[model samples]
Target: MGNSFSELIKNFDKTRDYMRDFYIYGFKTRNDFQYKSLRTYDDERRRIESWLGDFIKFSNSKKGKQISISCDSSKIEENPLYNAYRCKSFTKNDIQLHFFLIDILEEDNFISLNDITDRILDEFEISFDPQTIRMKLNEYIKEGIIISRKQGRSLVYAKSPDSFQRLAGNDSDKITDMIKFFSESAPFGIIGNYILKSLDKLNNLFLIKHNFIVHTLEDNILLALCQAIEGKNYVSLVNYGKSHKKTEIKCIPMKIHVSTQTGRRYIIVYNKQWKRFSALRLDYIKSVDILEVCPEYDCYLEKYQKNAVYCWGTSFGAKRPKEGIEYIKMTLRIDEHNEKFIIDRLKREGRNGSVEKTGENTFCYYGEFFDVSELSPWIKTFTGRIIKLESNNKQVENRFYSDIRKMQKMYEVK
Candidate 1:
């Protein structure tokens, strides 16, 4: 037999980790992946190519062949990266049983597990144990591919009627529009993409801006976190960072926060042990285990709502002030007549920040937050227009000037 087996993966986390390194980070040569073995890297590269052959591109680099994912987000209806998650592992019997069971139930009649086992033996000349058949049926039932109902004492399973087909038949245009929107905008949107494929439809109607395609990889994580948040349940999450050391954290999930600039997603949670609320990056979260429902869920949620107002971006400041506050004030040189949009943006995108006209063609934008540093990126957007920047934290003020000086030196500005 040849060395290569099926490209499908058994462990998604390993694939996801490698994918982020090569695909998201991009231009990673084989040698760049030093943590993993060369063989393992090659296998993962091959697997990624198998799943996203069209989008996978490589070029010769000084170090080695630089692997990267290349795709035009605007042209694509769905993110191709999501296919990584769908590449589930299967055995020979799994494929065989899947077809056998579906074919048996495609008749649209309810059949018992024993009946299925017998049919497989007589019709397909293959014998699957009744228990194995039952398990497969249960899985299909959960997936909505099959439906089970009580028939006398035992249960009977039947292939589920095509709900998508029926819905598409009634309002094809509306359904197409909705699916197109959902596939691009919503979490676990790849399902919408699958539905669109089934309908033989394309997303020709809408153009989405600021769609974060990478966020789809974290959809499974989001689903678990959202479910826990909905149920007021505490969750234990395995958060992995640069060192890849797993740190387990137990917290009460409050809300999901998405950045408009980078399209990154974060879950704001109340860390009971720390007695503080913090936002954890969704991408960094390796796994989430739903724990028991929080008894103080409501109280924590209320406290979080108040705490959220102080959150400028995601960081709730490293050092909570004695007065429980930090502040930032930025003076901008806006042409009051021509640059009203600048003032408008300050009001629109500033969150809890206040913008006021201080003098002729000058505006002051100020906000009180838990962390002044969190607003630095937004502060930098008005680089040329910034007359002065003041903050209670000296580090925040120093860092702004430090970054400005670095940029000036890089650009060779006097």
Candidate 2:
């Protein structure tokens, strides 16, 4: 049909791949994408422009016109990238049947499948097989768009009662506020953003600080991992590292950890074969397939929770001690008169660690974690105020000093 044309997309992964490229490595001409046709690039660029015209920008480069999306996450309440999820492809029959079925059930009457099909042929002058109509109706039933009841020997379908009016009764404003907050704060918040769009509402009520816009790229992968964890299922996934080398792993999905400082996300999973827990970055996961349920899911979950307090971040540590623990102690010089905030910070970000006063304007922080190395960066933050830092792992302790010596050499410090 002269190169089929449609604005909506069928495969979201293709859209996601192109969108991520555009979002991450912007300012590229169509010629930059040597693998795809110019037409393909044009179509996707057009599609994204249609969705995020406000954020789309163009500039002239020496080679050609460059297209890019410029979005300020802190300036906007909702993620515009979420628009990619809302554009869905539909066949001619699917669209036609949707209107026909909704128009037929508009009168609040239950109609049998055969009768519905006949009405479409007669009233709408469109004919679809009765079985096709039945399947469509069943699909709608599962989606809560239609309700069905047994009528004699046949099943009949009718439009489900709309709950929008009920939602608008009293607490609708509060509900909208909740959704506004959720759309920016929650994982898979694109769903909430879609709901807000359906309701024709704008988020004028809330603003999220430190919102991580790039994280929306990993939502689809996160959704799969969450489903697997919730069902206590094993997942087989393709993971790739910085070098883009692929590795296949089968593990029990456990938890999702988000870093407050960097806004990166990781999926914590347990590998039964290795008998160890490891965290994989969400972005590194290429694909995931849900597998059979893990019968020892609860036992593994309890063990993880018990040992989680010892985890500095997502790592279970390297060269774990025989006792499965590592210790760290830091003494910081604080001006108790004015630097109580430092002590408060040590207490706040210490996780399961303890802080106690050792002497006037001096405090000692003791922590036991699965990996003391992971805490090195955090410890470095208190560089000037650090009186002494010690770790049970000599490598971790020496590495800290080694880094300081390198910095001193670089700065030509005496």
Which candidate number maximizes lDDT?
2
* lDDT string, candidate 1, 1-414, tens digits: 136766788888888788777667677788888788888887888888888888888898788789888766666766788788678989888899988887888536888888889999999998777888788888888988899889999998888887676657978778788889888777788888888876787677766666667788787899999999999999999997658778999999999999967877899988978888888899999999999999989998887777778888787766453365889999999998988888899999899989999999999999999888888888899899999999888899999999999999999999
What are the models' TM-scores?
0.93, 0.88
For model 2, the stretches where C-alpha displacement exceeds 4 angstroms are 1-7, 24-43, 57-68, 106-108, 319-324, 409-414
Give the CA lDDT, 0 to 100, for residue 367 in model 2.
Answer: 95
- Stretches off by above 4 angstroms in model 1 are 1-3, 106-108, 167-169, 318-322
Give the lowest summed-lDDT range of ten residues in model 2.
316-325
Cα lDDT of model 2 by residue, 225-331, tens digit: 99999999999999997788999999998999999687778999998888888999987888999999999999999988987888989988654434758899999
**lDDT for each candidate structure:** 0.84, 0.86
**Candidate number with greatest TM-score:** 1
